[model samples]
Target: MFGEYRTLSAKPGYSYTYTDGWTLSANPVYSYTYTDGWVYHGRSRYSCESVIRIILAETSLRSTVQREDALNNKIRAAKKLADIDSNSSQLRQLKQLEKELEKLKKTRADQVRTLYEWECMLRVGSLRRGYISVKSNPAWYLREELVEDCISRGGCCSRDCGCCERRRLSAKNGKGIGHCTLECMCCIHDQGSEFTAEEKKDFNGRFGKMLRSNNPAFLLRITNAYFSKPLFWKIKTKHK
Candidate 1:
């Protein structure tokens, strides 16, 4: 006579099985076992913030470019009118438009410089803080997802999304929630080697050129390309 028997055990977190016959065997199974800590979670948060900042900066740049273009068109129209009629009023109007164009160019340069500086500050802060822990609970992830969805859809229109509130808070603090503040002296210490002044200037120059470029589409493309790259935390696996 021959006989065979099998036993199976299952639990919320894990499972196992055993079989007895001509041969015996045991098997173990686990549903989910990976735990992500502060570094992993913080990196994700920072990456998302970076992407959002790039998008916002690009949008602002595009708007400014459009305004500059409109002003140029107006100046051209004024010049053409002056050329055809040669009246004192037309001449004055042409000169005024020229002065306005110069002011607009200066304003655009300042805007670009400000955006570049903000980007530098963000990167510098990240380097200094390393990855600080934050609340990565389900509720937090849900809120983050909601915000991302709203951004993808152009913007959140409903108050329930809390997008406006989040923006207001960020603006008030000049940093994202859960970020380590300058007051946290320990946290302000550089996690990596500090960037040299020359390196910092070079970085600013590169971004300055990109931001000042008249081609809005090219700038948008570059921004999108940057955000499309895989984040470091995504590809890294930790064994525990």
Candidate 2:
């Protein structure tokens, strides 16, 4: 089980995970300047604020992906059940769910395109007061709380189904192998219930609470880890 965050290292490109434990943050560091060729392209300039916003958007986009993904899996599970026990009401519900999922997929597509463009705009970027340097761990979301929370959300972690341990590369993540999201079909199938609007609001609150003003360092650390875009946090020599 992975531990929660611990102290941050002073190094510009690395963080400590308790060595056998964990924590996170970064100190003030150099910033970035766009290269001349980048300017020649007449692209809108990048800023530290812009980068932060992009990272936040990435987090939100992942939520969108997870929602749709969960719904998609639920549809599959529903279909299987419908096959076993045919019900016109169930079939109709499945159709409606499929429709909703398509809408979400379209929204996700739009976000993905916009995010890709923004990321390209600042693909070569950095921080003002610090840098993001999460190590290359094939498995992210190792924090014990994240997994435990998964069970709380009725994820498969609570059972021998082994879904949480499946080394999943969720549509919700780019490079991290992590626990189940609202998207775990096994959990939804077993529970026979979906997340309510209030619960989803609560989950969103908990998920993004770290970004509060009181914990800006954590914001950077999570941003770095989730987006897997540390190269953007690298310090660049003043672009000549």
Candidate 3:
């Protein structure tokens, strides 16, 4: 039955052979087996947990850097604006922004120091003897309370009080009372006449102390301190 048997050698092997209308082929077939060493797919890789931790750390660092850069840019802008014109309407806003930036810088520095302390504590495997810390002095609360009382009794000429009538009158008459130089006494006296002698004495004692300690900037400082009282109290409570 080998009618067309032909021996065709190509590189010491036959490329194709036909015998009795049948075809025979010789080709290698590769196969793979699953083994313990083959589970890694021939690549070095980190564990899933490690990869997740790395990603989180990188994201946190990037966000922190961006926040710091934004704060710095805002500070620079405020400084530039403040320097451009002292009499501009935005002068107050620029000054306030500068003050806020300074506070933020101090806050950031404190946070970094606190973090370093905690890291050190963790490394040493010990706790601090007393972890309590004060964010603000207790004296600030007392001062704020005194200022609020004085303000309510018209010892300080708040905008909400009847003492504003004096300002309106002065403005109408074109006479500046120079309230800063006079310790705001002009407006206070105009409103104080309605209060009892005891009330007036108490107001005078507290207001006088404030004036003597900080003659020019007392009002501004007291106002800011009063407003910040709640924040200080919150921090104190957290520490406690």
True-vs-predicted CA distance for residue 63, candidate 1, Å: 1.5
Model 2 alpha-carbon miss at residue 179, Å: 4.5
Query: What overall lDDT goes with each candidate model?
Result: 0.37, 0.50, 0.34
Which wins on TM-score, candidate 2 or candidate 3?
A: 2
Q: Superposing every Cα of model 2 onto the true structure, what RMSD results?
A: 11.0
Number of the top candidate by TM-score? 2
Rank by lDDT (best first): 2, 1, 3
**Predicted candidate 3 versus true structure: per-residue lDDT over 1-240, tens digit per residue:** 111112311112212334336766422111111221110101221122222222223223322333344455666776776688666666877677667667755654555554444334321110111111211243332233333444554443234443322332333122121112112434434545334558646755665455333232443233223222231232111112
Can you write out model 1's per-residue Cα lDDT over 119-178, one digit (the tens) per residue? 665554432232121122212212332344334433332223343333324321222222
Candidate 1: segments with Cα more than 4 A from true spot = 1-43, 47-53, 124-226, 230-240
Task: Answer with 1 or 2, whichever has the higher TM-score.
Answer: 2
Model 1, backbone clash pairs (residues 3+ apart or across chains), number: 0
| Per-model TM-score versus the true fold | 0.35, 0.52, 0.24
Which lDDT tens digits does candidate 2 get at residues 46-145? Answer: 3434555555555556556666767877799889989988789889889999999999878877887776666566545333211223324434444344
Q: What does the lDDT come to for candidate 3?
A: 0.34
TM-score of 3: 0.24
